[model samples]
Target: MDLAQVKKLMLRHDGCVALKANTWSESTFTALQPLPVEQRGAYCVLKTVELVYLLCSVHPLPI
Candidate 1:
């Protein structure tokens, strides 16, 4: 998804704010390498992937 769509989805679910915080931390630290310049939305993408994995693991399928 594009950055705008990612932002909208995060805002809808309260994840946007946390993402902003993570971005800020990367900016403020000198030793910490900022997320790849190319992967501006990588964190959000990874988080969404993780959430999907968690849900699938915990939820049972209907027989």
Candidate 2:
């Protein structure tokens, strides 16, 4: 999906935001600064299929 579509989906989900981070970048951790404490919970991780499903649900495209 495109960045615009991804941003739209993220906005629709409450208290959730998406950040594009390189796996080896220290900025990845620094970029988490804006996320609210309550939303941060224990950790931030998601399964690949789960993420794909969410994106598809939000913006289904023609096959």
Candidate 3:
């Protein structure tokens, strides 16, 4: 999928997801699914031998 499609899908998700981050990659994209309310605004941390990655969300937290 393209950025526009990803952005659109993320926008439709109901949760507090990250809209921006320091970097991005294909792995940064989470599986499209319903997130729990408590898990909203949560950031996914992926650790590898060479690098540690963070995955953000498209859903914005309430102001």
lDDT of 1 at 16: 38
Give the alpha-carbon lDDT of every model. Answer: 0.47, 0.50, 0.37
Quote each prediction's TM-score: 0.30, 0.26, 0.22
* Higher-scoring candidate on lDDT, 2 or 3: 2
- Which ranges in model 1 have alpha carbons more than 4 Å from their true place? 1-40, 59-63
Candidate 1 weakest ten by summed lDDT? 54-63
Candidate 2 lDDT at 34 equals: 82
lDDT of 2 by residue, 1-59 (tens): 35566567667866374544544234435655687886554324533333445555654
Best by lDDT: 2
For candidate 1, lDDT tens digit of each residue in 1-63? 245544555567677333333433454343234667666466657655654443344341121
lDDT of 1 at 19: 33
Q: TM-score winner among the candidates?
A: 1
* Pairs of residues at least 3 apart in sequence or in different chains that clash in candidate 2: none
What is the alpha-carbon lDDT of model 1 when measured against the actual structure? 0.47
lDDT of 1 at 60: 17
Residue 20, model 1: lDDT of: 38
